[model samples]
Target: MMITMKQNSRAPNAITSLDVYLNSLKVGVIVRTPGDFSAFSLNESYRQTGGHPVLSLSLRAASGGLRKDPKPVSKTVPAFFANLLPEDKLREAMEKHHAEAVRPGNDFDLLAALGADLPGAIRVVPSEGSLAVQPVREEGKGKARFSLAGVQMKLSVMKNTGKGGGLTLPLDDNDGQYIAKFPSTAFPGVSENEFANLALAEAISMEVPERELVEKSDFAGIPEDFDTMSDGKVLLIRRFDRDEGHSRIHIEDMAQVFGIYPARKYDGAAYHDIASALNVAISPSAALEFVRRLTLAVITGNGDMHLKNWSLIYRGDGNTPALSPVYDLLSTVPYIPADGMALSLGGERSFKALTADRWKAFAHRARMPEPAVLRAVTDTVALVNENWWQLPERAHVPDRVLDRIDAHIKTLTPILTSCANS
Candidate 1:
């Protein structure tokens, strides 16, 4: 049975939180997104939905599609879950109360329910028009790995190093090489939108990593070359963590590098701090350039820009560092509920509070030369104002949100002009 929700009923509203469930045994983890994209676990675990989250889901995997259920079913999966009580305590609980802790839902099902018949560069569809999606199976190596699109990739359990989720892997094939990021649950779809914006960045000649999107699938449980509903659902991109010849580079989130470990303290680490930290020779004038880029992001309504969303990748050769591509990019003001930008602009915490002068001042502090700043800001305006909205023929974005963005851009013109002329 392929289940469907109301077309716009369950749409994500500025996805705010993500929860990660790490299997006690190994790197096997499951990311659970609550509230906006709320749903429950399909697996058998005492700690199911209500149990406390063991890990966090990476923001990179944007979304997945649903396939028809080829098999029979138990009752509908629960819509919510509770954290597991301490094992010692659960044993003492009265028998009748156990099931009460994990209430099942009658209507709610898998969050991703759309079936897809997406195309790829390498292969044609099998004789079967579409494929069904099954719950992830536990087999060979006891790993929770799956494939996507026509690509064969594996998901191994990750051990959390102090900095972030640690189950890092390579997304390499004959085409190009990239790193896959797996974050604990609660991450907004930062990585997913970043993949979409990378194409826009490249169009404007922004230096970035070579990457592409991959569909999700299963290996053992899924027949070889079978169609999958989850295929073409997630946005997979190349990781700048590694470069040519497969050498890993030194990379750290600004949070850890700046010593602001908690999620709430990320804003304290400014763009200038990150810019100044870079080795100058290879990334000549990168600090100033980044400031200009940041201004462009603000005016363009890429409200989701945040500390974890930004990165600096050092070439394995110890060359100068460069801003990782403009990833996790989106006009979240329209899609999300925060009603403002993720990382503040010019010290203003909210997007509605940002002004053109403040944007310029921020760029100046970043040490971007006036000319370069002007060019980056002006160039981005030209690229986006002329395109982006038209890029997607049938996207989930609302028209009103797009219109609001246009008005915001209009308001920014005078400020951008002052900088350009100065």
Candidate 2:
């Protein structure tokens, strides 16, 4: 997987610029600046197009609408692109293995290296005069070129059908139809927790991805380094951003929607902010979806519903967006013991702080009817209560996690009853 010294030396054969694309539409070009950083220029025609994906909501004009200036970025790697790349050990592993290709300090190079298949429909390919993307390297290292914008060790995988069908990190040129997340030693049984949580969500009829819990051996082209989890299982989520035929359906998490850096995912903004944004830009139904999921988090003790965990999915040629399928729904109180809400609800950051007043404040801020808000809360509690017993007793979840969820449900049950009586 090593790149030759000639390409590293920039011997007139290294990638210097990249053509950014949304699906087949030309979006823009990213070029190296005089200061050896990066800058992006939006294609005038694309900018003028009524429904073109503008890469991110952050790029929209301050006045809002289709107008985009694409402010000249001066980072070693732009923040938008930086958010698209993995963080921490995942990034280090990618850089270490693809040393000759992608690297840190300048994420533009990294994006170019792995841009063939990226999140959403965004594709970044080397413009010319360079061979940034090399042939399929030995082993599965070549498949590591795809990117997912989080600190977690995640992979985009393609699923097989018929016979002994399983998932594989495709060595050929196709985006993963499913996103595979492995179990964490730091937080054991996270996959199981998410599987159970998603089961509840599906039972409630909330929009959610098709999910499966499979063994690590289920993967066909997984790297040897990641084969440590012999008995451990992986969670496979059908990619919502891809169509039935596997074409890209563009998406941007609220973090990308707000133009905030990934480090600030937990900082700044609250649930009210999300509701307000969804009301104005997306739809009232999207905001209602937020309420349903937020209620699920409160009752399940899932305290990590940060901005990055919520997303807006763009479908068709229309610029309209909808709340994306739920993901990362594991209960955090099991691990943190005292875990609460990731963002404040009505300005409170505690699970015990979820009261009638908070729901009133949240509905007031979002400009939704209080009865509608109350209905969402009551329905969520009812759905989980009804579905809990239906989940398999041997759901692969840890006993402590189940106990925590039961406690939250008990805590919320009376509250819902109190509100109904009042």
Candidate 3:
């Protein structure tokens, strides 16, 4: 029911105390804290809709008693959609795709081998989504846990809360609720870029959820000397996941619905069979098809896409699961000197060799015909090219960053078009 930890600045690892609750609740994951006295609880309520469960939850803020109003909070996608999948069957499908992507002499399994870290830094939260983080035990260390309006914030061991630093805070800004990500050094850097890419993808006609780039100045209670400053960076982003004032439908992540879900090649059988496997509303074929198009987007160098990066939001009396608006979009290929592919595109960590041939290979593996893949590729490229420059100027992306994106677009267009048409 409860767990405790002290600040340990060592290698990236989950606080061991979380193991007890993770073993017990079967849904929650526990994390670390900067100080003491941060607490929260997650109570999920499921209702049947169209033969699928529409999950709604109340995130109660409590330390000793009933704290904030226990309003029902819902995300975009239902996790049960993945629950219907059988692991072995999905693995079989993945094997087939792996065969297609890996060349005879290559020492890598492009579509199936790369291990995808959990999506966004958020899932680093306890699986159960409830937490009772005792603040860091340093003298004069204020309660690291704080809330603004109705949203709450907490720190954790090096996990991706998208904070670009270790301190992950939840806030109610822009009249909507969101989790602000500040990643610690031990985590990945592409986390911030992915959020930018989310914005780009949404603008390019990809359906994603509504999100905003939150600034540190926009947040209160943070120390003026907080170690967030690095390499001239001064701001942070907060993701809008909950509209705290209103009750909405909730759909969870694919992994949350099933057991430990692996992030592998996007073309795996899991993509095609998750709906039926999980017995949720999404059909395997449709889910795989959606992923096919998404894969093309990634290999074309949208490398910021990851597991938690993609989600299903609820609509229509907040009961049905639909993809959230694309947010946090940016071109990492020419930006970040890390990997060239988004997290696990068609399962490959690097898309440097991704060509028209590889595109067809990926399509075949996803069970989507090559022609459909071609069309989707063409459409996405056109949309990105048409809107790339226009969007950066208006979105939260800074001007210098926009110019770099513009230059990168020119460099990327040839590859994108060739692959799409190929």
- TM-score of each candidate? 0.49, 0.89, 0.51
lDDT of 3 by residue, 167-221 (tens): 3322211121343544324323334444566666666656555444344444444
Any runs in candidate 1 off by more than 4 Å, and if so which? 1-139, 144-195, 217-232, 278-284, 367-375, 387-418
lDDT (tens digit, per residue) of candidate 1 on 202-265: 6656776665444343112222222222323334455454345433343434443343422333
> Model 3: residues >4 Å from true position, as ranges?
1-176, 181-199, 208-215, 223-227, 231-240, 261-300, 316-319, 342-348, 392-404, 419-422
Worst 10 residues of 2 by lDDT: 3-12
lDDT (Cα atoms) of all candidates against the true structure: 0.38, 0.75, 0.38
Per-candidate count of clashing residue pairs (backbone under 3 Å)? 33, 0, 66
lDDT of 3 at 13: 23
Answer with 2 or 3, whichever has the higher lDDT.
Answer: 2
Model 3 root mean square deviation, Cα atoms: 14.9
CA lDDT, candidate 1, residue 249: 46
Question: Which candidate tops TM-score?
Answer: 2
**For residues 214-300, could you state the per-residue lDDT of candidate 2 as single tens digits?**
888777867653443424678888888889987888888888788777778887688989998998888787888889899889888
